[model samples]
Target chain A: MKKILIGIIVVLLLAGCSGGEQVQSKPQDQGYVFNYNGIPIVVNTDVEPVLKELGEPLDYFEAESCAFQGLDKTYYYSGFELTTYPKDNTDYISSVYFMDDSVSTAEGIYIGSSVDDVLEAYGEDYTGGENAYIYTKGDSSLIIITENDEVISITYQALVEGLN
Target chain B: MKKILINITCIVLAVLFLAFLQKLFMPKYMSSIYEGNLIEEYYDSDKDHDVIFIGDCEVFSNVSPIVLWEKYGITSYIRGSAQQLVWQSYYLFEETLKYEKPDVVVFNVLAMKYNEPQKEAYNRLTLDGMKLSKSKIDAIRASMLEEESLITYLFPILRYHSRWSELTWEDFRYLFNKRKVSHNGYLMRSDTKPVTVVPEGRKLPDYSFGENAWYYLDKMTKLARENGIELMLIKSPSIYPYWYEEWDEQIAQYAKENDLLYVNFLPLADQMNIDYSKDTYDGGLHMNLAGAEKFTAYLGKILKENYNLEDRRGDTKLAAVWQDKVEFYEWMKQDQAMEMEKYGYLKSYGAAAQAIIN
Candidate 1:
């Protein structure tokens, strides 16, 4: 009877622990990092240091998060756009969207690059969608959207951790 | 025999106690985040409706059932919740069919963009109000995030036990009863925050709807067809979270192939007289009560023309019930207006009140 009671209590404790919200750990060494000028910006990491390093943005916008507290902010640069999601009163990089072909990914893949070029650079080990190919490394994903054999959009996104 | 009887009684009492605790611990969405209460409000309504609108915040905040009734005498209900996924909407529709069948089922296509389970808070907002059933079970299974467990949903006490420390009077007062937060599932916002600039949709990596989203949509279509209901797909005219042309084309193509009526109302905002400067409540994410009335007036006409629906105003019993709804609607509208007048913002509605309090 004592053993059975102890087992039940242990199970309940484990269940309680398992049910807790899972906070995604910040990527340390892995994940794709975009090099803007001399600064390197990584997704799922604190955006403050990167923003300070990158200087003033061309444009900025923020909206109260839908059905959640805090704000979703966007900063537009010359060739790319950086978006951040607020958590614990601090902003974390959510995504980096390439706007023009003037800038390329850290991997040398740019807009107007061929699908073959992407395969050559990033390799064939990617999840292929109808028009987009997603290459994931650790917590970050490099998505290249193609149309007519030419890449139209390239974006690096952090895998959303439950709530943003 | 006596020992067995005592043990049985104790077991029954223990079960009852846990159930009571579950009820008490549940978040009573009386003051804030009223969207959580929208789902259960459907149970109180007279279930005989000509149309059912199901989706996320887009349907609940954009469409007005009161306006539909007043203009065309068309009875309708919107079963919408915050960030409602496609599978959640499908199960909700399946559950709604168990109560009553509407002639037309309108599903907002915005939720199709999301392929996976979103925030757990959003899942709770949509699912907690739903009564325990096979549909709710299926919905919970389909909607649970990576961290969420089935047992937690089954026994809400397990999920909300920690909420004991945070329990307010609202929780205790609404332990057995919930306040009516929506009018036929429409969450009314009388205040306006006009659109300044409609942000362009960021270039998405994939424009194609996920296979999971398509699967549920196909299921929804089949379910509607089996019930002899016309499924109308709509893109509500909220300008933000920008609805892409590519997404629109795919839905349009699917609708064309399936012989369904697909309407993208964004471009027709001018015809609908939806002035973003006045119509939108939160920039461009959702429409205010004024906007919903205008949209509903336009939609009511189309629904009347296309669908085989009778203006149930002639039905004395239904009319009587709707009369009460109209009265309540008017009272709430006036009350909200009064609150706005006094506070310069709604004091009892949404995060505004919490902001003021803080």
Candidate 2:
């Protein structure tokens, strides 16, 4: 009776020990679901989640995330993939940055009304240090800045006529 | 005393239950089981295998163990892992010593993998395989769960016990329905078009004989030599030849200093009669089934002529098994060709399984 009682107690104790959140599968084991700023979104992969959560990416590539072959596809964030497409087809998200875990914004030019207007929009928070040069390559704005506080000259190049 | 008995009983029951559950739930025959045995079996068989291929996807996608086994009667097996490293090779050989021993061990070094960021957990998991026989409790403890073994064992739902929720109907049926393991074991696609990798001006890092990698290599060499086994370092064909050449120089220097045999096959792809554009399933890093067949056959001839290995085919106990496996391979080959045609290079599960046998 005592042995049986012990067995029952043991089983119950084992059972009691159970029940906790399963260790989230490794990042490469399956698709990912992420909450970006309280918005839940499912990204097909780690890379996708990172890109979606962070914003625009700098550069990325697909790779196996582990030493084993069983891992699902993972993306290597090399920065971001940013391009200014024509105004017709795609919505412009502007310059994007990509990372292994997430993507984020990088400091640079803005697209809209005028150069000084863009500077005022970013305000003093913009780290345009000494010798900072802002220019426009056609419709795209260009800005180059250095370490010490300096505002370099800004230039606006003309947009090519009938450019796609 | 009662409490002690209870703890002991719990551990034993937990272990047995875990074992039973693992057997019941796990895929009946996994690729690891086959790969684990394939190397030992070839080594044990009376027939001398022509070449022993090693490395990761670079080897499996490019070299067919079965083709080598069948064509040249070379009892070859691919001891490659997914993204194999020089360290894992050490453990594999360590484990392999328990059963059969091979004549030659080939090391297919990858170029991009030299500076890989290591994974501590995965390493611990693989290292656990080395400690399975001390006791059942020890075995459970030594598994991939590591510190989580107790929790996972008792609850199971902790790891795969509740895995039912994690899988789909397709996965459930496919896993439960399989009684036999059929596979070619190659996952990556073979490419033919040559790609270039020009490192932005970095001289090859000195891969001298004193580092951890060199220590493992030295140990492996000494182990093989002590066992009267030959060691060959072969570079699998790759699209990026520059990286291969760079590593090849380092490996060759190591070989020259250590008195080991080294062969560079990256630049020999065309010389081996591999059709660049079509024979490759990918653009070039790996080989397709067709490419693997050619490469394995060539490798087999090399082992036979150079190594003076004896092809002990008809007399080995594994002959019957090999014959059946070959028959399965033929079926899989036909199925794969059709599937590839239909799926257009994106192979299905069945095609993937068939690929291993091929």
Candidate 3:
């Protein structure tokens, strides 16, 4: 009887420990959920939610929208400036001028995020490729244009992969 | 019966433990643990390649190995990792030699910006070469050295190891969402263009007859020659105006001293007719998908005409294995045409970025 009682307690403990293991979320799943221009959107949910998660970018534009824009391919995010190597000089773009600033009714709670979050999470690529940008990985492609600070139009090549 | 049960239990436990250990040490999947496993798996070649491209984001994001194989018929592999520096390149080449013996090595100089290699970089390079061991100490050592390895190669959890208690309804979205089409390899720039302004008369970093940068350049050349491999110093195109005078001067000097092949296509920005105002993905530092197509085409021609590289795509043996690359090249050409028609703007080809210095 005592052994049976001990087994039950052990099972309960194991279950509790597994609770922490189940918290993994893909970019398309949940990190930043929002409704942009009436489209239910989530960033970093499926894979690492790059800025492209805005869904065909509905007339939106950012400079560095390509695959290698910021964190994925730049010195700034490689823990280099802070932990690894210090650059001789560093400059950050204080503000971006997009031709269009019309907010397409950005709704949805961006929980536990800051302006830096938007920058690091999505804005880096947008801001970096401000002049001209190309985003490509494998066959997936998105071309973005920003005039002042507003995104213009983002057109993607529909030749996607692994759609079975 | 009791004795038999005990024996079976012991055997089963042993097998499970071994399997677990194998999964922990030499994981084949991409996750948090093995950061570069994805790259290694995709670019694995049984024999030595003709060319090996190494460096940081530029190498992986800009250059396509599949394109090289299809165009030049040269079996090339671009082994780049996120934020990879020169030191990491040194170790990666050393480790890659164990599997492949390439004749030519192209080292991107931008990675020279990295002063030294880090513990994580060192650990990944080291662990990628090791096989699984049943020893607990070895596993712990690997985990300590490169935590991502623990997630990628050994234990799968480290890759997907997130900090959520339970997934919400949003978790299911990935299942229904459309997966982007996988191409030969390359990311496309968005159409949203940014108006760029280059600072005039910027004091450029000098690449004179000799400098600190040249020291590493010499070291890489020596390393390549000692191994009987030819080295090519390449500078990929970026939108930044500085790439022209300052960056090109240094590359040219290096090429001149070593009699090495140096290709500087920056000044031909107008001649190449690259829509820098549009084709640049990142403020002119790197090319977008459109830019990569123009740039890679020039690179491929250089390899073909100068190096006497033969297109081995038709060779039965080479074709059998690299079949995907051949198909990818065809797809890339098709994709380019599709873009040209879709966008209604095609830039004239630039002077091919090629060199045969020696």
Candidate 4:
């Protein structure tokens, strides 16, 4: 009889343990959903609604440049500048340029992130000069522009072969 | 006396050798990337044109000079290249006036979207094809990037010196005389990549053309007026690149202020029978030969009715030139079609945009 009572208590404990496992099996918090038209808004994403999701920019205006002739308008946020095609400021966004550490990517990579952090997040399969680290996966790339081993800015463009 | 003769001979040999090298190194563009040959081919023309079109690929690929010649007797040449900027147009217009000032100068307003130099490669395509002159020098000054050197423009060997290994048989054959790549500045491709979905233009905070673009447009207007040429601003029927109403209004307002004729062809695409799917080759970005002819037919009517361009098909000299061009056009269309049939794609005709989304 005592053996039976002990077996019942063990069964109740197992049931309690299984109940706790359900909480652990709950869905994980997803990363930032940066996308437009199935193509990840990434760095060079130049469309709408994604801009709205990024929220209001800190500053926006036309950028002056001798070399950069196309996509004249820019939306300056805490950590990035979202540039658009034409200085008219109303068009498909051409390029999204990350500026500082104020904004973090879903992977926690930011402006001031260390090179080690990038390698840790994007893996070791990346190519660029010492000052620039490009982590490309298929057509989308997370290009980390650096200064003194720290990421200065992040730009995502289609790393199209032969375009450069 | 012997030493002097030897030195003179050496100098001549050196000049000939350098010229030969320059020719070899120059982009043949015969097999691939034919757009590279566009700007330089302008000088090859007879320079007798009733209308001179100046803009980017939007003007070159969209407007067919042959269609204009065949239908309206419009002898036209487009001094166009890929992503040509406004200042480049102004300079090209200036250089063009030096050769032949046509009765009508059609400037595509799309180039005005770019206020500054875009790329060295594109700049080379537009500026390198010119004969050495003050206009070329000024264009180089205005259009060059900071990293770009003017010496490369003067001596093309520097830019293409690395092309030594890339020399092909086409390079040798076309060294002295280049086969006409364009039909009087019309690059032809008969393929079609229909527009499945038209791109919608997003909202912009501003619609004003930049100060530099405005400055160049003003200069072009003044230059055209001085040369007794009527400058016509047109937004060609490119189904993509989304010509916004706000931009249209701005151009319209500018046209109103300056008393110039500005025609936005997006609205009239339907009336012009431009069904983007059937008409455009690479979707809606640019029209195929069918679309160009359709658009050109519509434009010819306008040029005749408004611009009062005379029919030059009656002129023997012009007709002789145009007849050959027409034959070449038919040949190019057939050749492209055959190429598509053989390779399942167009290797020539600048790859004819496999599928340019933007």
i-RMSD of all predictions: 5.4, 14.2, 16.2, 29.5
Estimated TM-score per prediction?
Answer: 0.90, 0.58, 0.50, 0.70
Runs of candidate 1 exceeding 4 Å displacement: A1-14, A23-30, A53-56, A113-121, A162-164, B351-358
C-alpha DockQ of every model: 0.29, 0.06, 0.04, 0.02
Tens digits of per-residue lDDT, candidate 3, B1-358, equal 9987876776676556544433333322221222233244434344546778766556655666666776677777776554454545665666566666777777766655434333333233334434344322242242342123343435423322231333334333422232222232233333323435442222212223234345556767777778887777776666432344655676777678877787766656665567777776555655656666667667877776766766777888877778865575566556656665776533221101111000
**Which sections of candidate 4 miss by over 4 Å?**
A1-164, B203-205, B350-358
10 residues in a row with least lDDT, candidate 3 chain B = B349-358
- Identify the candidate with maximal DockQ: 1
User: Quality of candidate 3's docking, in CAPRI categories?
Assistant: incorrect
Docking model 2 quality class: incorrect
Give the DockQ (C-alpha) for candidate 2: 0.06
lDDT of 2 by residue, B2-90 (tens): 98898778778866765555434432223332222222223333333434555655675677767766776667656554444565665
Q: TM-score winner between 2 and 4, please give it.
A: 4
Full candidate order by DockQ, most accurate first: 1, 2, 3, 4
| Residues B183-264 of candidate 4: C-alpha lDDT, one tens digit per residue | 8777787887777644334323245677999999999999988888999999999856667777788899889998999899
lDDT of 1 by residue, B1-358 (tens): 9987876776676567667877987788788878878898999888998999999888999999999998888999999988889999999999999999999999999999988887777788788889999999999999987778888777777677767778999988888878788889998899988887555776676678999999999999999999999999999988878899999999999999999999999999999999999997888888899999888888888899888678878888888899999998999999999999999988897632111001
Tell me the lDDT of model 4 at A49. Answer: 64
Please give, for every candidate in the order listed, the TM-score of chain B alone compared with the true chain B: 0.97, 0.71, 0.62, 0.93
Runs of candidate 3 with Cα error greater than 4 angstroms are A1-164, B1-38, B43-48, B117-195, B198-219, B240-248, B328-358
Clashing pairs in 1: none
